[model samples]
Target: MSVSKLAQERLGDYILKYCLLFEINIFYFTFHTTELRSKHSTKYFLLCCFQTCFHALCRKFPPSVNYRKRFLTELIRRQETVDHAPLDELYDALADVVGAEEKSECYKSYLLPCGDTVSLLENVALISEGTTGLVTWEAALYLAEWALDHQQVFTGRTILELGSGVGFTGITICRSCSPKKFIFSDCHTTVLEKLRDNVQLNGLTEKMSPAVSVEELDWMTVTKEQIKEMEVNTVIAADVVYHPDIVESLVKLLSKILSGSAEGAPKILICSTIRNSETYSGFKQQLEAAGISHHVITGPVRKVFPYNRDSFIEMITLYK
Candidate 1:
């Protein structure tokens, strides 16, 4: 069978597993080619697809060395089944990755439905720099997917994202939802630094019209005056309700932000992975005690990014 046919069959697997490349419209290749140019036209055409995909993979948003090595190895293995001679570009790409120095940091790119990519520089380890915020979490992916569907909530509104981590949810909203301004906040110095890098990596700098800014926001000590200064219409946070102390502080912070808003209480959205039922319930209880009403948002139908789907992630909208 031809490479295009083979790729068509495995496209879904590639997207779900690796998420290294966007969906390539195979019809583009077939429709554009009127006639075979050479005896090796099929091989050449397949190589063109690889080159186009890998150009973005290598230059724009390269995955880790390990992922790249595995991808190239699989490609070469598939090629061997069809032809005896090896593709030089594939071999060279593999060699480069094999020889490249491995590092703690790597880039991950998520393909959006609008054909734009939200690329982030993430730490390979889940916990790095004495914090979990260096890497994007599953809850952030779930929140981002939800945001894409509810763009109207964000459009023309200023948003404040608490515990922004690596800025995945904020950047995705800035790119797609048309938010008027986005403020990414985290308490940790390391997390704030990486969050700034990710915001810049996605090209949502402060200079943009829908202004983007990163700030240090410690929920435990943040005052009502500080919340009032932000002038945000919406507040969001993801994966921050895991710890009891954090949940307490987060509830207090949300109370202050809601009560202090100049116009009115801003809309609040908190997405959390239900890692511990006790902790999740504690969060809800605190919200109720603070006179904040919240309800679980209906989960988005479209899953845009690859994440741990088995994790029970819930989105909650809050009002004061």
Candidate 2:
């Protein structure tokens, strides 16, 4: 392959991975000054990179205003160095990007496979209000995509989501799937507050069929009454199996719910991004010990959400 083609491919791959994940520092490193100076087709390469980056940011809903501003600022600087007259369209696009209100919290929109968009407001910080549930994790996106692919399983069923971080998966399911009722449960105060806002932000406030509800569920201290009251025919959770104690508490809660759930036998779907091998293995071991069986679901070929392909997300369904 030609050197110019190789460089263009490399830059495209880098931007798609880092920029989509909001990794601003990595984006700069990928497009470092030394590499740009060395390339002979500097103008073409820079323009391609700028156009590609701009399109990617826009495609990924709830575009990160801060990241877009930083990316455009650097692109403008580089364009000025290469050509005395930068593109007027670039400046206009930058102004529109600047119009995105800077705030501690922001919305992210995801275009579902069913032609529906899911938008959520997330904390700028990864960890906020003493919990790491303020933002949409890759596993949540993974599960949401999986649910979209198999809507038949959720149609007309009462679905309950545990650890509904910012309500991404739940809201997506609520909008895309025909669930009879949707319940979002979280233990943290701030997480629950934001989850409700996200549910409303999607204009899902009408108390029609598939009525949406939020509940404060402490897995460690949950009561039997709460489990019985859920009346959920299906339970789903994403990115909730990070810590060992959490795994045990979550397993206990699931066992209690499965043992006494009035919905006969509820389907349980858990999607987890395996950051730690031990944590994932521990979760499986606990499920085996509890006599619950799980099956891994295959992922779809088409992309529904903009997330890293190498995130190693896994989706599993549990049966009693």
Candidate 3:
């Protein structure tokens, strides 16, 4: 059910008061936000109680069926407010990119596809929003785009994306050129819903239809079936280099997925920002030492997100 603005405002404000009063750490988020440090505050104090409560409520409640209107409103508002973008705007932007010239359409602000059924197809969509777990499209696009530049090399190739958050990078290429079979991998089942929704949001069913195949390829828990199912010829990862501790393990997972190529040697494209630069470096060195070959197209954009001038995304295209 839809929460009215009046009720939401009241509940949100009330929740904010109670939570912030209950936990004073929220003010720190507002105060510390200007430091150029990107820290997400899930637990805000009383003043931000609604934010937390809202998320918790949504999680408790299944995906809201009545959110179409709300999301439509949000999508429009987001496109207009990109200079001062909100989470919704990023999602709309990610959903709006179209391929094949004028052959694309959007339902409201989201792209509309030919059908609801999904199969392995490589299409590209804008990846925006996602400031949480997955790599931000703002940081991941450069790498995906680079792969697009080489699209002729891998057209109709089987592709896979691990930890595909909101799926901007993967969807974008799929729309640009039709790939034979495609797989989208993510660790979180919740975000995968959005990822599937996003694939449909872009008019890509005829181009690269949705495939039921979302695998939980946690870097630490990757399995052979996951790799076999993925069977991707080209793999791309973006903004995943921030977690230094798992760099080696993450690369290992990539190794497993990419190891199946018998013909032309598999290729992998990775773009990441260095929250854990030293560890990321270690991962890179290890990948190189393995006889696996790769080309580093770009590296972390040091400025800030979206607005970072001279901020280049880190990219690595690996082959074995």
> TM-score, each model?
0.85, 0.77, 0.52
The global Cα lDDT (0 to 1) of model 2 is: 0.76
Candidate 2 lDDT, tens digit per residue, 1-320? 23466666666655554453343353443454355555353554455456444564445444567876776677677666766566676687779878878777765656565656676778888987789999989898788878778889899998889999899889888888889999999999999999888888787764866798888999999876777787889999999998887898888888887886765868888889999999999999999999888999897565666677788888888877
lDDT-better candidate, 2 vs 3: 2
Please report the candidate that would top lDDT against the real structure. 1
Off by over 4 Å in 1: 1-18, 21-45, 48-53, 82-85
lDDT of 1 by residue, 138-201 (tens): 8998999999988999999999999999888898898889999999999999888888888887
Q: Arrange candidates by TM-score, highest first: which order?
A: 1, 2, 3
Please identify which of the two predictions, 1 or 2, would achieve the higher lDDT against the true structure. 1
Best model per TM-score = 1
Error of 3 at 62 (Å): 22
lDDT on C-alpha atoms for all candidate structures: 0.78, 0.76, 0.49
